[model samples]
Target: MDSDMSMHASYAFKHTCWGILLLFLAGGVADCSVVVTVSGPHVAKVGSNVTLNVFITGATRPTIVWAMGDIPVVTWTLGSSSPPDILDPGGVLSIERDGSLSFHNVLLNYSATYTIRVVELGVGSNTSTFTLRVFERPSGDPMCSVTGVNGNQDLQYRCQWAGGTPEAQLSFPVLNATSSGSGDFNLTRKPSQDLNGKEVTCVASHPFLQRNCSVTARGPADFQPLVSSMVDADKKLVITIACASTSLPVATVTWSKGNQILTSGGRYQISSNTTLLFILDFHLNSTELGTYTCNAVNILGNQTNDVSVLGPTVSDLGLFPNQEGTMVTLTWETPRTSVITGFEVQMMGPSLLPSPGGRQRRKRATNEFGTIQEKPSSARSTNISGLDPKATYRFRVIPTAGATRGQPSKELRAGPGGGLSGPAIAGIAAGIPCGILLILIIIALIILCVVWRRKRRQTRYPVSRAVEKVVATQPNLNTPHTLLTGGLKTSAGPPDYSVHLASERSSTLPSVVSPPPVRMATTV
Candidate 1:
């Protein structure tokens, strides 16, 4: 009985040992199933530092391997004393002891798929993928441009921003529109009259930064008007004026004189486009001469330009000076009318008196008439003498009817050295070159004349024989014989050169041609 009990205890101890060994093996197998968890898909901006961390489970003494697109980047055994092995030549990549990958100043070329493999010693290995993306921020604010389309009925706004990894997203807040990744954004809308002078804005968005730009909507700018007058075939004065303006939808132009608006009628003719105004058969005595206003109106704003029309005052005013430059003759013409009683000649020059400071300081010259002289209505010209030749002068003529003065003529300037006017100087300057050219022509004519005389002497006998033969073959006339003399063919006989001497003894013949009559207009 004692032997049986000892054997049974031994058997039970063996069974307990086997069961404990199986349980230990099973736990070891479970621990060997290594798993790697990582926060993947990393994102970073250029010139920034980033890290891709990994959380590893069921690993002991983990050996970490990091690769980027099939290329090994770094590897290290966790808890090792030595530094992590970095396979990158630039040394910009590193691995931490916790199996995390670090990038110092990431570059665009570093953006790719990265794989991290965590292997537990005497266990299985697992991998986690991390996608790295490098982005670039926009350099500046987006630019905006506006243009008219569809016959200027609609305005198109465009916004653009260039140079980024993924193009920036653009939006127009006014239109509630966004870009479709086409690199630029566009929005078009019909502009209403009330929408004039409105502001439009565009915005650009990116992961790294955001920007915007704006423009203004306007209308009716830069108004211009041109006025001109001329005389018609019927001797009637005609006035014409044209106006233009720049605007988005075009503008309407209107013409007015004083408080009365003008339209196409008996005398007034407006163009179909309403940009031109013409007054036909304009009479000086009529109430047509005044300030004419052209108003251009549009949805945005209005602009006005004024043009003045006046009756005939003075025309064709001329200034001539003597050779010594001390005296100047002023001549002018006017429509012979009873409205103008006489004319006033006004002159302006430097003050002859010295300043109180005892120094002749140059004073600003003014248009105020210093010397005024009146001439009768019949006098067309007058002589101004006893003038300093070295003083510069400016002259203008004002027409007066009893007490009221009409418009003044344009100012004429005469430089120093007597009354040498601008036209006189120009004439003198032109005459020099003309004189030289005339002399050269005269010399050429003389040389030609000499050569002609020699040639005539050589051919004189032959020419005489030929003429006699022709005269003998021609029919005889009842009148006196005629001869060609001085290269002239005359119906009557050759003119007697000696008759001029006899005429010199008698009174000089009178000029049959009379001066042309001047046409004058009636003035009010």
Candidate 2:
């Protein structure tokens, strides 16, 4: 046992002596300084190639090891015949002899803290670390939207770009504004006239991509005006008109007549915002009955609408055909007041054309007014005659007080068959030609029968064939008012003084006809 232990101790002392000798030799080389530097904390986009270069000084035959975080990736030794030993099984990482690291078709997972270690067998060793950040390039163009703010008095514009790493820088070039970090860029302000129809742009900038989006600013739109009339105290008529509009910037409202702009004055009241107008002492014969126009103007454009007031006329005039169809009874209702002296009935129908068969064909002629008939104010119904039973006719009633004629009533139709059913009239018309042909055939047959009978009877029976021809006939069927008023104020934007005549009565007053209120948008 003593001999075995002595042999073991001698072998260990030899190994220890060799270790100390190597250490003394290493210490001599350790005096040389080693320095290593990697290019940077680098940046690269996915699917691209990048290199993290390394610089070394005072190092010889160095062995380099590269790691990502705590995980080993690749190792290379200077002047080694063997290739680098890559820890990565995917083959995405590579190293050069100079201790540099390179990435091929980089991926997002490749982003990490990368360390390069340089070592020389007899010299000092050094390590350098850098961060590699992998980012995705911005995809597609930026998106934008607009919204109303401050009760629609201002507009807010927002722009954004998605699917980019580390956020993208966004800016409104026109406004010279920018947003921080990854948030969207927003701008809000009242729109100006000059901005109307102009394009607003947002640009997004990133390390790997650039994109932009835009929108057009708009002006005034959707303007409408309403007009109404009523009876006020002192038995005077009052008229009210209002206008409204929508615009990026609020629009201005103005009232006008033909070639004239109206302002607040005697008998005329306008709202401060220029949206409402009121007329006092309105009468049927007054000059305040012409067309009144309202205009809404904005920086972008303008829109206008018109309303007219007129005199009273008749209503609901109806026409009824008599049993024989030759006459039509006309009935209508009038306003409660005595504004109308009488009603004039106007008739229009086709003229009769002579036919060889003594039957008449009605020929329609343009502007063919047949006759005008008059009825007293107390009479609500009257009979119109001298109409062709087979022809159609149209009639209208005009309300008249002496020489002044108010607006006319709606037209009514009286028809092709005098009191005949539609099917009966159709059948009669379709059978006329067939009846004529049948008559000729029957006459010929009768003549032949007569001659044959005469031949058989000879002197005993002398037959006289006389055919009486009967033809079946078918029949055919068929303002300005002035108002009296007091003196009114006038301006350069003068309200029209021409009185307009209309047919309907107002809700509160009888015998008052005003222009029907209209809603429309007229672009200027």
- Identify the candidate with maximal lDDT: 1
lDDT of 1 by residue, 131-239 (tens): 8899887666688876666765577778888778778988887766444343587787777765576777887888777877887656767655655555567756566
Clashing pairs in 1: 389-418
lDDT of each: 0.71, 0.70
Clashes of each: 1, 20
TM-score per candidate: 0.38, 0.36
Q: What RMSD does each model have against the real structure?
A: 37.2, 40.1
lDDT tens digits, residue span 1-524, model 2: 99988876675455445434433444334333888888954788888888899898888777777778865567667669888666664568888767688888988889899876666775777777899999987667788766566765677778888777867888777865444335477787676766776678887888877777887666656655555555555656576777766553445778888888888998889988677898777555666667788877754567777766445478679889887777889999864432455678887776533544666565674455554688775678888775667777778888765456788788777876436546668999999999999999999999999999988874442322221111123233222223435456667875554432222222345467754544444333
Who wins the TM-score comparison?
1
Whole-model lDDT for model 2 versus the true structure?
Answer: 0.70
**Ten residues in a row with the worst lDDT in model 1?**
19-28
Error of 1 at 369 (Å): 21
